[model samples]
Structure formats: C-alpha cells, structure tokens
Target: MDGHRCPGEDVTVSVLATVARFLARSAYEIPEKDLRIPLERITTAPPSGFVVSGFAVPPADRSAEDQHPA
Candidate 1:
C-alpha cells in the first residue's frame, strides 16, 4: 500500500496510470509561483454599489491594494 493511502485499503492501478500517478504525486510538493498574467491585471473600475441614499461612492476595503480611487 502507498504511504499516502488510508490504512487497510488497497488501490488498483494500470501501468500508464502508475506513471501518471507518480508525476502527479511529485507535482503536489512543488512550490507554486505567483505570475502576473495580463488577465490578472484588473485595470477596470469596479461596479459601485448604492450608498448614502444611492448617491455617494461605496466604502471599500482600504487595506487592500485594488481599491478604486475617488
């Protein structure tokens, strides 16, 4: 039994499935790196919600970097 498995349970596998499983297993331990894809850049103004009788700009999460400027 693989060490990752629950105790007393046996897993079935085929040859190709075994190779695929090994690659997938190693991938789990690799650290993920953050990337700035263009789609990730949110350059658009976020839709404003109703505030102060639906007139004023809504309050935002100020601590966050993606806040819209007044």
Candidate 2:
C-alpha cells in the first residue's frame, strides 16, 4: 500500500547507504577510454560496463573510530 512502508525498506536503505559510503571513501580510477556510453540504447550505459582500475580503500581514510564505535 502507498501509505505503508515495505518491510525490507529499512534493510535495503541501510545496505545502499553502506555501499555508497564505502564507494565514496574508496579511491579508484576509470580510464578515459572506458567512458563511452551509448545514448541510442534505451538504457544508456557504457558498452563495456563501468570499469575501474587501481581501486583501493585507503587505511588513512578509515579511522579506528569507524571500525569501533563507542
């Protein structure tokens, strides 16, 4: 129903937020050659898919507080 929230909404939101945060803090590079997207397609997406290289999560960016909450 429109008035009621889906039971899985909270979990889905949490998972998405966690993933977004992880991605935001991660260091990665997308090659310029891989930036091509086909606008003619109904779903405009990269032909080779979104590719990234040298992906890493810097230890400095992650603090002990983030790993252990008080």
Candidate 3:
C-alpha cells in the first residue's frame, strides 16, 4: 500500500491528474527556482490552490513562411 487512505482522497487524485495532464502537454520543464511557496500559511482546507510566479513567456509559434525564412 502506498499509504493510509484518507478522506477527500478522490479530490487529491483528481488534482494531481490535472497537473500531470498539463505537464504532459507543456514543452518546457517547470523549474523549481521560479516557484514561490508560502510556507508561513498552513491550512487543512479543501481547494487550497497554489500561486506560481516569475515565469517567462514561451516563444510564439512560427508560421510556415517564418520557419522556412525565404
């Protein structure tokens, strides 16, 4: 067994699945240096969303002409 099963386990699994899906579709790896975790605040509450900061914008998709560079 991975660990003791707890209440709201389904919700936890769902959130992790969503994050995994997003990571799978993303091309770049999310660096730890850019993360800002609020360690001062701790709560045993549901829907505790996280905030991400200091990320660079991804490059724009190039058109066929731009790719070939005539």
- Which tens-of-lDDT digit does each residue in 1-70 have in candidate 3? 5879888989999999977765555465433553345666675322334445554333442343468786
Better of 1 and 3 by lDDT: 3
CA lDDT of 62 in candidate 2? Answer: 60
Question: For candidate 1, lDDT tens digit of each residue in 24-46?
Answer: 44323323343334445476332
lDDT of 3: 0.57
Q: Once superposed on the true structure, which residue ranges of model 3 sit more than 4 Å away at CA?
A: 1-4, 30-70
- How many clashes would you count in candidate 2? 0
The estimated TM-scores of all candidates read: 0.19, 0.60, 0.35
TM-score of 2: 0.60
Off by over 4 Å in 2: 34-43, 60-70
Predictions in order: lDDT? 0.41, 0.82, 0.57
Query: Which one is best on TM-score?
Result: 2
For model 1, the stretches where C-alpha displacement exceeds 4 angstroms are: 1-13, 27-70
TM-score of 1: 0.19
The residue-by-residue lDDT of candidate 2 on 1-70, one tens digit each, is: 5698989999999999988988898899987766677778878877777778999886855675598877
Winner of 1 and 2 under lDDT? 2
Candidate 1 scores a C-alpha RMSD against the true structure in Å of 22.3
**Winner by lDDT:** 2
